[model samples]
Target: MSRHSEIKKTVLRGVYEDNAGIPRSTHGKRQSKFAADSQEPVHSSRYPGKAVLVAVLGLVALLGFNLRLVTVDVAGPAAMQVVEEQPLPSYRVQLPVPVSPVGALIPGNDQLVSPEPIQSLDDATITSGRYDTMLTRLGMPMADLFNLQVQTIVIDPGHGGIDPGATGHLGLKEKDVVLDIAKRLRDKLAVTGKYRVLLTREGDRKVFLKERVAFAKENRADLFISTHVNSLPPGAGSLNYVETYYFGPHTDQRSLELAEKENRDSDYAMGDFREVIARIGDTLKTEESKQLANSIHKHLYNNMKRRNRGLIDAGAKTGPFMVLLGVEVPSVLIEVSCISNKAEEARLSTPEYRDRIADYLKTGIVDYLEERAHRRTIEGGIIQNVAKQER
Candidate 1:
């Protein structure tokens, strides 16, 4: 080849070519046209290695791109492309920490909650990334914690407004009696100013079971107290007793009946509600509630039995009442006195008797709190000893 042709060949070889030997030009740039000759660039398909090299180079360039964006077209018959890839935002999923208007959860290792605990079925958070929660590494509440203090309480007066609950014994309305007892209990707790107390209803007004639960959950109640009067079949022999309940599967037919009655007007679908309740039943919430029930029932029966000799100790029982559902803390429903029993109804009607019930409730609460504090002390000591050992 002549010197000029050699120069031309060298320049043509430097030009970027695709698999088809098509030279791609930069904008506003023109290639030097040469006479048609045998030295013209051959199709890369003729040299399979050249075509492979071109594809490899395209992939390499795509990877080295600053944006790291790419679109591969392996089977589309289209060339590989660079695309602006957007990634989804990453977030940290955190479980809710309890807070209340009356008292925020104080920073402590003790993670105590109420006896009537309810967990939200819809509290799921979708997130990506490493979140550092030791207790809830598996999206479960810390069952080992003992609350350091009982600060906020929600008192629920069952049956209000048009729903008069059980109305059979001596014309004494459950709505009125429970409300009265709740108010008196609220007053008793408030007088000490040691606890932040709130009532679900102040007067005879309609409040749905869900509403009561929402109120407690919203307020981040440490303890939830639901006051209700129990009723037996009208002819069922004078069953006068004081019973307390925590969230659990009903233990008896009577308990199931009570749960059905209390669950009236609750909007939750039975299937979904039972599923959620069953899930919660196996967790710390249920266990804590049982503890609270035992405490309150002990106090009520121990103190009240002496005052009223005929008072039956129905004992602390388990029932799946709607009012107790979704409390998200230690909570209990107290059947202070059976409304079906004319004798118990007569006692519940008096102001003095209601005041006494409030006092008993307060004692139960205070006792539970003291027990909680003592537990915190013991747990704290254990943790400290473990740390020291590690050191």
Candidate 2:
């Protein structure tokens, strides 16, 4: 071959042949033509796959960027989610301590002697009504009415100090009115020398419901009487009456409302009342309390009516009073008068009227004790006969 032709073939081989042995003569010629037409020189390399790889990488990056934009646009804003907060746990309520006069010890001379053993009686002749009638007709020797002699009585004046309960339109506080009556009652009972009387609080001070119960129990009281004055809403001016309550489930809405109001004075939260009521229902003296309440209501109504002709008969009621709960003896709460009424408030403010209330309450207490004694006497006789038969 000619030297010129050999040199030309060598140059062509360098430009067209790739390292991988692929022919790129046509691509090289097109690149050379493009370089000639443009101002810049064309670059040719043996590794043509590198250029293709770089172009493919650029295209993949652009496609990934576009896909990311599309994904962001399609997703938009996320839906707002709401999560409810959980309720906090309930805590126990703590009550305050009470301040009151300490109980006094009874003297040995004040104690009564035990009764003599009863003579054997025939059971065949004993019927409920006939036995009672015989005792009444024959005038049987009256022994002590109770298994034990009644001595101490506790009179609790409901609400005091910070708790000025059930304020009347004329600024008469239930605490003050009930305290005054309670003092009168205590004085009257004390003067008799037949019974020892104690007051839960002698002065105006805050006394917790549980504290009052504790005071009565600590004193070994035979009977518990809580005094309170009733009040109505401003709209219920005409609804004036006196009511008595014993510890039990409330019968009416009015009784329930009164209980709720009376129970509100404690430092403890009212939410605990449901638990308190449940507990009190199991521990109350149902029949004994009811009887005491009836007696007190009867005497109180009759006595008050004598002075005030239009006095209402607000019948004996059962309510879940916190103050009356946990009392060991027969317990009753008296709503002495409706202080909400203009006329009744005026009457209740008088010393003479309050003294009358105290007298009626004392009478009721005496009546209950007498009836209890009579029942115990008959029971004692029956028990003696049974003992003789057993022997």
For TM-score, the strongest prediction is 1
CA RMSD of all predictions: 30.1, 44.2
In model 1, how many backbone clashes occur? 10
lDDT scores in order: 0.64, 0.63
User: What TM-score does structure 2 among the candidates reach?
Assistant: 0.60
- By lDDT, who's the top model here? 1
Candidate 1: tens digits of C-alpha lDDT, residues 1-391: 9999997984563342111122122123223345466466544331223334346545644554221211111111111121124333331111122333211212121233322223342222222222222223322233233334677899999989999988854798999989999999999889988889999888899998888988987887888999988888867748678899988778898888778878878875555566755655444455556656766776687688777778788878788887777777778999987888877788888999888988888887776666556555544543333333323
lDDT of 2 at 272: 61
- TM-score for all models, in order of appearance: 0.63, 0.60
Extract clashing residue pairs from model 1: 112-147, 114-329, 114-330, 115-289, 115-330, 115-331, 116-330, 116-331, 118-328, 161-205
Off by over 4 Å in 2: 1-146, 266-284
Relative to the unseen true structure, what is the C-alpha lDDT of residue 9 in candidate 2, on a scale of 0 to 100?
A: 90
* TM-score of model number 1: 0.63
